[model samples]
Target: MPQTNDPFLEIRPYHDEEVPAAIERLVSDDEFISAILKYRFPKLSGSFRWLFKPLLKQYLRAKWSKIKTVRDVQMNVASYMQSMIKNTSEGFTTSGLEKLDPNQSYLFVSNHRDIAMDPAMVNWCLHTHGFDTVRIAIGDNLLKKPCATELMKLNKSFIVKRSVKGPREMMKALGQLSAYIKHSIDEKQSVWIAQKEGRAKDGNDKTDPAILKMFYVEGRREKIPFAEYIASLRIVPVTISYENDPCDAAKANELYRKQEDGAYEKGEFEDIESIVQGIVGQKRRIHVAFGDVIGNEFETPDALAVEIDRQIYKNYHLFPSNYIAAGEDHASITDTDRVLFDSKISSLPEGVAQIVKSMYAMPTAKKSDFPIKQ
Candidate 1:
């Protein structure tokens, strides 16, 4: 367990010393054991949970016996990630990472797409290189289950309290979050956070200025200049491009429902289901592009957000699907790409198909608006 007097203990990831206790707790937790049974042995899990839970717990205990530190947990996760990539993706590639200094910690603000894969990909790239993996930022909304919280924290994820209500409570949570991020950077630990609160369902990747504002909360409290504070964090805008989104159809359906009904509601565990599908579903190719650190003078959050968006747009990799959706020709577009893109579109309703097409096309559209900086 974490020290009782630690202020950030509630939100921070588990310390190396706390890993053993956490692992033991997880193996013993009924919910966690049941979840494993359901995912791995679905047909038998519902009727035979009593039979499988104990066996699963024993298996997990034996499997995780050597995982005594946080680094051990991350290595285990990395092994699974490698297997998942091999099974679900054609290839994974990265750019601009070679330019980064492994010795320096950075704040990576990336465009959100998949609930979990965005940071996972970033961490994988950094780990494969000489750089240390980043501390991921995940929202509280995704942690309704205690087991989920344990699993995330075990993998170096910190909580962002998005569920906090009331203005005072919200402000307090934001302040603490900002302070924790700054503290991590000061300790030479890099952090990964989305540019906005949610995934860009519409495929339009824009940095919410409010997110930038939240980052400045601690700086403002200390009466520091905004530009200097921004520069100090070494903010790097990262763009993650997928040749095909695993949840594209679901996203399109939700958007279509919202357009017709003016509101859409999620099922109790829909987010969790999406996370699972994203991990296992097919993603043809993925590219992660790390942009230059923001050292320019920007006096306001909005200005900083604009620069971040520009970099994301410029660095975003345009896949064949994007070119096909945008009705543009590219040397990379082939007959196979056309057939695959068409199959995806044909699987959706006409209205939802248009939305999905637009979603894929937005990257191509936005690229023209923000040309690459020479």
Candidate 2:
């Protein structure tokens, strides 16, 4: 943990000066090392841990010896990101990035799809375009393991205390989070948070008004007008579209089971599995669209949420798969697109396949209902 008197020390990412110690902690963490071994050499990790664990630890220590700063860690992550993109994606593209001021730190509220890839793709785009990466907002539920917390914070992520019980505690957590976000913006550091608490597993992206309300918790306490306080944050709505979601089938199955069982329970490590799958799975093609920074005209969180949703829906890049699943005719649709879409659908059971198709079709359906702003 960061040893400091800072109020947000418990939730905020580690500072540059703290990077070396954090790295050392991670290097020394037996669970972290074992996790890596299980991931990279799954078969050998169980039966030959005596032989592989020490070697892996030595390799990690040597590999991270020179990484003394947060930027160095990010640069290393960037290299891996580049390799991942090259191997797992057909192509990556972006729009509306030119409109953002490089020097101004904006609060980027993005549609969540993949647990790990959404903010990562946003960070990659900003990093490659000479803009500073945003401090990501990650829920505490995702940081159940100490290693997970270390990894996330090292990557410029702040914790959102989602599991805090009781109304008063939840409010306090939200207030602290809101203050941290404002403080980050005031310090000219950008932030990226999901529009809601979790990924849109069913593929429908909607901004929850509660999230917007949470943003104003601190502002409300300070007696700041909602609109003016919102404007000050330079809130931007971002849309990320994937031609192929690596976890679509898994997501669909989960959703379907929930529908059948009336509730769903996640395995202890299911989220971790999803994160790894999202990182390594083929995405076909991906597009990230940065939207216009919102103005101060909206008077309430609900209204602000509507506008954010509007931008996300408008800016979402519709792929041929989306159109095909929606049963819509489009000039961009091709024979190969049909074959690939069909193959994905055919691999699942009929019920789950329908859910998967509906998931892909949702963006198209939502976009059609919400027309673009003039």
Candidate 3:
């Protein structure tokens, strides 16, 4: 059953005849799905279509396409990602792949800005470079469906279990996550992870030291640091930026919730809503900037965190919107090597201004700043 907030989630794949039998009953009976879809996809729907006019059955088949192997899943995800970049970017440019050594494995960490496009853009970069690319670190909270589950796993996404209830449980999960991440990298493959758990809502992209420390709690508990374990894997910073975010409303709600409730509860509904917003929301020309590869062998997580932020800022691609926002917000601009702010803005049309502004507004030098400038 779909939650009242989003009727779209409730509309799973179904045959044509089954529409009246399976899907239509919801719109006729629920009212919420009817009201929301009518509001959102009005182009595809008609007045009476809500009840008896019927929607196309193709969308159902689209979700359940086909997935039998990990390879199939990987290509599907890559191309699905490629389609978004090809379709969304008015003009896209990438730099710094030559800085990455394909022969070596890297622990790729990046700033988290846009939820939907970060991993997709990262994969696009690696694909274009001919590397097998990365196994991404995704939160279990985002795996809301079978397709999402298979897609991430196919693309080498390991889940960080967010459901642990106790400190002891949390410690165990951290150790397991550490081992899995190290194993993936030691095999000469790279892994992509946001510096934080979710998209840095509100455009703040700072690295969380706690996440860095989680990489070694197993050794800490045993009276020895996991430097040996960490040394075996290479770490790199990737900076990903979207020309615009498709989910600002969701990001804004998160900022509001943190201010009001002291925390945000990303319930199943919020996850579904974010995913919906990720796909259907309007996004203009997205760009993912690649940062330099780094050595993950570190003395401490704090040191690693500091270095991560440095590398992230080093690779940040500034545009006109960021310059303008920084000027307006009185935010300090420290890095100005890539492109001049005014010139960057001059490159965009009015339609792309909102996106450029959002990217510019991102928190500098943090994982919350979705530079994906890992």
Candidate 4:
């Protein structure tokens, strides 16, 4: 049930009017405070935070006292993002910004690589290139805690219903999602969503037709052709490539477990841990390429998906690490590149090493050797 008569109230990000209360609730939450202390000051928090909970609470309250709007939240965190980019990555490169019209809103569909970094990178690119930051689509699975939910919504991330059980509920959720996306674009707000539900652990990036179909679900209520509806949305395909994944070892282990057991179960805080690792870990180099918008030229979801996949693969920047994993002699790689890449995977166990190698290599194969589904 929504708190208001607005149809998207349940799933939409918090409004400007609600930012103050959401921040207050988040800072007051024990789970959030504990998570923050553990994330920011893990070494001393165990002994210090527990001993001085009141002091911690007072500090947080004063720090976040002026965060009364969504933009304020983004501005507050901008420095942290810039610092991470400065320290962790060699550099960030982007292409195709000149292709986009700044005044027009677009639906950016990108291949998911890292849980939080996928959208964060896209948003960063847009923000840096004089475009508005996009409203991100985040799954409900990551919003299990009240503090997590408030923080995400405050940062302009809307929830996607991933755990809906019944078919009817699933359909309803998708419909609402589709409607909200269309509404956002119509209102001149850009949106960022993954091409699939989860990150491609093995690095073979492909668009899921189900995700594309959801885009049409709400638009079909107007009795228009699917192609026309899709064209109206001005959908843009984006691809982001990381030279090195921060949670590569964890991702490899999970993939190996799935191969061995045919399924894998995740711990409750696994995603949060990955988020922390991704923020702090070394990425070496990063590239984001935006592709041309798919207009009335495509009629079916499969066709559209193939087109998106093609752009993603074609624009994916290959680093020395990718070629090294593929067992190719990199006559082009500098000495520093070789050393940095070697040190990244030097300590991995044999089995996980193979999985990590394949993860980096698959994108190259998809682009050159093997073709993704037609």
Candidate 5:
């Protein structure tokens, strides 16, 4: 077990020593077992749950029995992710991988789209290209259950305390988070975190300067310049573009409801629904672009955020569907592109349909307005 007094005990991922207990804990949870079976075999949910539960639980325990470390868990799930990508996406491609070195560690700041797949895609790209998988940053709010929490930690995901109360506790949490991120990189383990706290529901992908400020929280204690401290972390901006968002329709519905009501309330299971939708829905093509590390060039958090945004905007891959939906001339679009765009927006209500179009078109518009810097 980890030392009882460890400062990071509240937020860190499960250590190798704690993996066995986590596995056991997750497998024995009736809610988790039922959820997984229902997700994997929805047709068998109502009357067949009794028959499916024991078999599924046995299979899960057997699968997790040999997993005694984080890497073991990742290696086991690697094939499952590969299969998910193959089934859900038409094709997956990566760019700017040559700019990275396997021996070095980086803080990969990515634009978040899907709750689970954003970091999963980045990790898959690195692992397939002969690099170590990154430690993912996930929010505590997503861990609605103990089993869910254990599963994420077993997959090398550390929790970010989003629900902490009071300024003192918040500051303390951020300091510990900053220290943990720095320590991971120093140990040659890369880290993947979103540019902001939540997904850009409006399709605008901008880095929050507050996130950048948090990175300097611990570094400031060492009395280092902001630029030097950021440089030490080797921050890289990542851009992931999906030709068709797997949850575009769902996101549009949420956007419309939020607009209609002063405040939109989410059901307890809304995030879980989104997670499942993102994994199983069709994505035409997905592209991941890795930008060069932002070294000691930016002296301020705003400056750093701007540079990261620029990189993401410049590197974002725009599909023909994007152009078509943005109301570009249909004459220039190919037959396949026009057909794809038509089918996507045909069934939606007017408001939701417009939101979906804007979601896909925003990246194209942003890229067009900004010239790529050499």
Candidate 6:
């Protein structure tokens, strides 16, 4: 993993000048950067942090009162999001969130494009439509970073644990997540989760069947039908795009290195760097588009899964690469189109071919061509 503290981590408050140097050393170790961040900055524990409790609680209380009603919370959240996008990025443009159903809770399953913008834009879109906050699922491994965990919690994020090494542990974690989802929806709220555990590079955004299976734990020989359990909460598939995802080249490198080996070598610092780059890197257009909603009104998990996948893939905006890549065997676009694109690539500098191929992992020729459900 890339060390995030490569002089950049010094941006945050540092009690000592040596703090950055130590962070650099710690981030460079064999251990995951997350483990390092956790060890160095563990979550507030026991009574020692009580020193600041009064002050922190006061601020939180003030923030809470300032955001009393659901409407207040939504507006506040949108303003915060808007300010963030404006400060760090060029600007964001979203379409289709107005189509969201406010009366009923829906599962906002989306393709993971930009890390920060994906969830932020989705929540902002929903908020504009007067919907309640959506619970977001982020990896527990990520919470090890000092500031990030606090921010995620503030924004209604729940952890997705990756350290469940045994089936028993995994089942328990899955059950806990399921129950949390139930709690959120029962309260007439929505949840947004990536279609898969991680972002799809190479442009394939298929929902993992295992993820779908994990969502239906309550249906086996129990009081609820699997279909009803899912239908009870509406699942609205959404698609997001970044004209330029800052991490695109990094992602391509990771994917290529992973293909060469089995996985990419990354530590917790890589996540930190990714977070920072995502927030501060470039000026690009961000778009959040909503797709159709799929519900338990269906009869089975298998059917529901297929339907949801169809919906999500439909809304995916396949940029040029996804389009031209298909021309190899797809008759919709002429080979002339592929040759023309390749000719443009040929004019680029050295190693551009490799980079281009990696960058467009799943680049789409067209984003609007995904299938619409019957």
Summarize candidate 2's per-residue lDDT along 94-169 as a digit string, tens digits.
9999999999999999999999999999999999999998899999999998889999999999999989999999
List where candidate 3 sits over 4 angstroms from the true fold.
1-67, 144-147, 218-228, 260-268, 280-282, 328-359, 362-374
Candidate 1 Cα errors over 4 Å, as ranges: none
TM-score of each: 0.98, 0.98, 0.69, 0.95, 0.97, 0.69
Better candidate number, 1 or 5, judged by lDDT:
1
Model 3, residue 92: distance off in Å is: 2.3
Scored by Cα lDDT, where does model 6 land? 0.62
Summed backbone clashes in each candidate are: 0, 0, 31, 0, 0, 19
What is the number of residue pairs that collide in model 5? 0
lDDT of each: 0.94, 0.94, 0.61, 0.88, 0.90, 0.62
Show pairs that collide, candidate 1: none
Total backbone collisions, model 1: 0
Q: Per-residue CA lDDT of candidate 5, range 1-374, in tens?
A: 68989887878888888999988888789999889877878788477897887888789888778888888988987988999998998899999989999999999999999999999999989999999999999999999889889889888899999999999999999999999999899999999999999898878999999999999997898899999999999999999999888789888889999898866788999999988888888887999999999999899999999999999999998888778878776454789878888887998999999999899889878887668786
The C-alpha local distance difference test score for the whole of candidate 4 amounts to 0.88
Task: Give the range where candidate 4 is weakest over 10 consecutive residues by summed lDDT.
Answer: 365-374
lDDT tens digits, residue span 164-231, model 6: 78989888777767666666677686788888877776556666766766777744425687777777
Off by over 4 Å in 5: 45-47, 329-333
Tell me how far the alpha carbon of residue 194 in candidate 6 is from the true structure, in angstroms, after superposition: 0.8
- Cα lDDT tens digits for candidate 1, 204-251: 999999999999999999898999998989999999999999999999
Candidate 6 global TM-score = 0.69
Q: Write the number of the candidate with greater TM-score, choosing between 2 and 4.
A: 2
Q: Runs in model 6 with CA error above 4 Å?
A: 1-77, 87-91, 297-302, 318-370
